[model samples]
Target chain A: MRAAVCIALAVVAVAACACRIPEDPDGTLDRVEGGVMRVGITESDPWVELEGGVPTGGVEVRLVRRFARDLGARIEWVDGSEEELVDALKEGSLDLVIGGLTSKSRWKKDAAFTRPYVETTTVVGVPAGSSLPDDLDGVTVAAELGTEAEALVDAKTDADVRPVRDLGRAHGEPAAAHDYVLDDLGLAAGTELKEDKHVMAARLGENAFLVRLERFLLGRSEEIERMLRKEGRP
Target chain B: MTDRRETEGPFRRFELPEELLPEQRKAVRLEWLTLVYMLSAVVLLALTLGQSQAMKAAWIEDLLSLLPPAAFLIASAMRTRDPSAKFPWGFHRSVSVAYVFAALALLVMGAYVFFDSAFKLVTAERPPIGVIQLFGEEIWLGWVMIGALVYSGLPAVFLGRAKLKLADELHDKVLYADAQMNKADWMTVSAAIVGILGIGVGLWWADAVAAIFISLDILHDGWKNMRASVHDLMDARPRRHDAREFHPIVDRIEDELRKLDWIEDGAVRLREEGHVFTGEVLVVPREDDHLVDRLEELAHHLLSLEWKVYDIVVVPVREIDIPSRDGRPRSSAVGEEPARSP
Candidate 1:
């Protein structure tokens, strides 16, 4: 009986050691049990979306889901546009804004961005036989306002820019109004949105947390990329 | 019969001029050296990983995460190049460049660990040591530290041995130097294991101190080699003063040729072609009646120096002034006797 008691005590000790709260002196995990992680995500096609009234598919969505799992927390996804995602993150309603966010100095005040997982240069696509335009000028170009693509267009050309609400519309929209659509890595020279690389953002003070989380995520990124490749872009 | 042969018979001779096969053989050895270095590192690392207080075997594994993939990339890149119009020299140096890249990766890895540990040590932040039960014995990480030594040491020995052979045969300086670096790394890994064990025995600063020393050593070696490989790629020449040994042989050849009564003056210049030396000698012969036969014979004789000279070109100068001695025609002494190799 005494031996049994000692074994029981040792087992208990190991169990207790396992459960002791992680001394995250870095405060990497923003919330303990009750702390809700308000994750602001864009409802962009292919990369993120809401399915059956629950958080669903997209590259960033899946990436963040795995991150949440590692942090031992539940994610409450808040739907919003990229601009609204930035605002939600800034207003403190969201703990992290996940989507195709790129690192820009202008967003320094609103949200902190993680190290770039993928870097890409802009590419222009045209109808199979159509020649690619030399520049965006004298052409109808589509781009989301305040995006790197739009900034590139503004800096590189004198074209009459058309603002599009979504990436799909920007590419799927008729090219008669403009020669091309500029957005992130993909340019719709004809009528298709090309694939590009983007980033995820969170509030500034969460820098340490995001940095560590990014590193952890990057280590397991092959799996995340494999999942993305399996599920074609939305 | 022996005297007759010695006076007017042929000398038995064989010279293994490096061909495609021997070069390919050296390449294979280089690949093997790279593999041995990597495997030994993994094994030694596996041994010492458990000794550290914070980073368990798994953590060390994670830290070592990038080495294999980067090494694979370099190995693959070397196999991708084919002979092209733009690159007629072939991509032999690509192999050297790839090796330099591997060294750079190792250096970067060392730096990353050193900086991270130094910051932690300075802040007095003691990392949590995770204890695991192995083979029914409660083993502290001290054993893992010793394992690291074995992991780094064994492969180093293999690489050093192979590299010495490869260097002597192929005359590849980079591979030979890298072998020395690997030997040094074995010592570093051994030191790191000792430091980690010291930490396990309650000397907290031991592990970090060891890491700092190892990092500095790896950084210095890596930086020096990377710079050299880059210099070679830029087609830099050896300093003029440094060419003294070979310079004497070329000078003596020209001096002997000038003594020839039938020759006016001989100008010689030397250049390296791969692992051999080829000299272009300009001779102003007295007449052109037997010019072709004489120059060709002279070229053949110079190339007969199997160990030192590989190829020779003899250019006959038609019109050039000669310093007269008693109004006698000067013939090249070089055509009469061979120049000694330095």
Candidate 2:
């Protein structure tokens, strides 16, 4: 048994020694570092936004531009729906996709995600003079339609949840939105609801590129948070 | 070997002077050693329990591997106890009881791993493997996981080799079964490696695919052992240790019964109670003169046929209900007579 354990340990040592660092199968990191980077973008508020029919603004949009320059690569942006961009990313046509994708993104299984670069939270906030209630049970709370906060509010509280197209304009009324937007809408925070871990998508199996991108994004967490503070201003 | 006319049964018993006592001690020592090895393996496997389906399976298999040694050791300790008023048959059959429970665990755990991996495959759940830092270097977690599996799995190969040798010497089914399990460990390690490496190579489904195959293999082993042990519990004729074929001792004892000059024909039935056999023989007698003396001698003779024979009863009967060589219709098998020897 001792001899067998030793043999196995030796094999592990050899395997570990063979590659101290993990290598990407398609060499995405090497190719992108000194070449043009193809980026897929979609309109997601605060992370991505489209102005004049071109992808622009948002924290992730600006971060990707900086990431491209850091890699010494030129940037090219492609705009499409989440499904279309994800399919193209899977096909290796686009190196990265940014749409304020969260851990709860529907395309999670189909794409490789970088480590979460930033974490955002949803909270039920009320205008300053409103008395703070212990909980939202049976209390009407406005949550944005088609957002994770909407589902989180329903799951985490017995609130008389009302879905609206916009939570920003629901000032003075108790509502669930990104915590950063609470102060902008003149609402004081109350109940902390749920958190979202935001990440970027890469083609599956691009390990080195994913790690490099993760490192790049994770390094600027403070900057991402700072940029997020300016978002959704009236 | 001399057939000693000794009293030994549910009502009475005595220890046969074991010439292999030292060897038995060695076998117990070996079992304990194997147990320790598996305990360490279980720990190592637990540490590598990442999101990969294959690693999870390999961990479960190693965890299940600890059962055989435990059963064997407990049964050995119980085998030495004296019969009590509450349990006159003694603890000789404790191993058989343990076998059933061990088989049950194997079946349940194996099935769990199998279905979970298959579900992951069908649902297209990508394994969430990422990077970890080792000595200030960011190495992929897959390499560490695979390496841990190899380290955890390798010692079993050599342990299996050692157990194989001990099995031959001790003629122990438990040791042999454990050895067989160890031999298959390499296949599991290789399959898991393939799965982990597949993830590295861009085959997203490779980990799940490999997991399904590994789980199927484990489930097969579990099913086979479960069937065998359950049959043993039902007293389905004493088969060879592997439960593949009938033990030759049955035929030898029956032939010996027929060889007795006063017996016109004879039939024997035996049941395995762990390491030993207890049985009855029915004979058609041609003569009754000095029959009582002859009966004791024959019973003694049967016990000496093999070390596994713990006790035997020789009875004079009008006739033996010889089971037909051809398949008896199911209706007849359940007809008028309810109990018939297979």
Candidate 3:
């Protein structure tokens, strides 16, 4: 009886291993590996930018280009609004969508999201060449109203948080803004505050595609940071 | 003064019949063991629940599996309690009550899961079970799920075998029902395996199909156990653990009573109170001399019949309507004992 049970278990194990490639629900892996890689894009600046109604220079654009080249597939970039692109992704007309979507995007329920490939950190920074405070305990920090940076500065530090319309016009006070804004606002980066994790979306049930895409993103974390830095520079 | 008997140290009780004490001890030990092993299985299956519909159903089933063992243990504590001022009939019926609760849990959850799986089939929901990162290597999550399922399922086969033996020896309906559940658990695990493998091979509806079968198994166990326990509560004749067939000892008691010189006819009426029997033996006496002494002696002799004949009374009746008592005509409760020959 024991040997029979052992034999049964061995049979089960062997049978499971037989499916070498966990078959995709929609055959996304087989189609996109050597054929047209259908990419949908919307205007989310610094990740995807529309130039003359076409997708042009952005960090995600660069990543998608490399991904397509590596898979030996031709890229077919379809430019549309976010809603249109997401609808297209639903119908399987588009393989993936990239537009600075976060891990917590509303589209999360409608599609499969890759693990956050990049985390954009927010920090309280002083203008360049100004002495960095040991702590923001007594400092006044300016952040855009109704933004995560405003909430972060209020919670993380004892600074007098000043909500502003924009940080573009320099407020001499330490400003709570995204780390990517350091060069644009001429601020020396300081203590970090909040993080906005950015992710890419794919048609749901395309497990093989999602896995491959996530693997690519995870394997080249540093490369993504480099592109993010260059693309976000104002 | 405190009264306690400890043949098996943990399954503590007071003043059980000498013959049945060991069987009760063995049943209690097996039940405790069931709780320990099932606890492990529930935890293991929970960790591997991942995202498979079949795994979720199996995990929930394992979680609920704790109910019967726990109910048995709790009822065992109450089953042997002496009759109190408020509850003058003793707590012997606790086991039957516990059996109903466990069976009801199975039936209700089985219905929910069955419909849930069927709904998934109708909606064509594709289960998105994919690869997971383990120590920097991507492994198929199905392998881990199946491993946990196998671990959860295999032990029940052996455990079920042990449980059925004890169930019969102890005359425990709850244990018998739980044993049946455990015996069929392997089918649930095997069906889940095929479902997971089916998903691996890109058949989306297979997991839901397997879940339907698993729920049906649970439902069948619940229905059978519910019917038996309800019959017992209704004061139906004491049945063997296998159901329908009356316990042979019920007839044996009647045969023992008829062989005496003073009895012209006798009919045994017995109802199960948990693991023991309690009812009256109706007899028509042939002689009046030494009648009281003889009936008392008969009751004592019936109590010693290698079973938990905990409470029985031999009454001298003018006539025992054999067909009525033995057939579908008698609806009298244990309360009416023929006024004890006015």
TM-score winner:
3
Interface RMSD of each: 13.0, 4.3, 3.1
- Give per-residue CA lDDT, model 2, range B1-342, as digits (tens): 123345564333333336766767877887898789888878876776656889888888888889988988998888757779898667778978887777788789888888898887797666656665578565677778887888777778887888777766655666677777887888788778878877765565878888878888788888888887787788777877655578888889877965777887777778887777776787666777888778778888788778777767777666566552233422231224334322
Per-residue error (Å), model 1, residue B251: 7.2
For model 1 chain A, the run of ten residues with the poorest summed lDDT: A176-185
Q: Residue B32 of candidate 2: its Cα lDDT?
A: 93
**Model 3 agreement with the true structure over B55-127: per-residue lDDT tens digits:** 8888878877889988889888898776778987788898888988887888888888899999888977666
lDDT of 1 by residue, B1-342 (tens): 010012122421212243634754664556565665565566545544532422332233223323433443353345334446787433434544655565566567566666866765685433322223457443333444455455555565566666656555554444455556554545565555545444443355556666666666656665665665464445433212212223345655666676676677676555443233444677777766777777766666656544344445777654323332224555543464433211
Query: TM-score of the A chain in candidate 1?
Result: 0.54
Q: Rank candidates, TM-score, best first.
A: 3, 2, 1
Q: Rate the local accuracy (lDDT) of all candidates.
A: 0.51, 0.77, 0.78
Best-first order by DockQ: 3, 2, 1
User: Every prediction's TM-score for the first chain?
Assistant: 0.54, 0.83, 0.79
The window of 10 residues in a row where model 2 chain A has the poorest summed lDDT is A14-23
- TM-score of predicted structure 2, chain A: 0.83
lDDT at position A45, candidate 2: 86
Off by over 4 Å in 1: A1-234, B1-37, B43-84, B99-128, B234-342
Give TM-score, chain B, model 2.
Answer: 0.88
lDDT of 2 at A6: 53
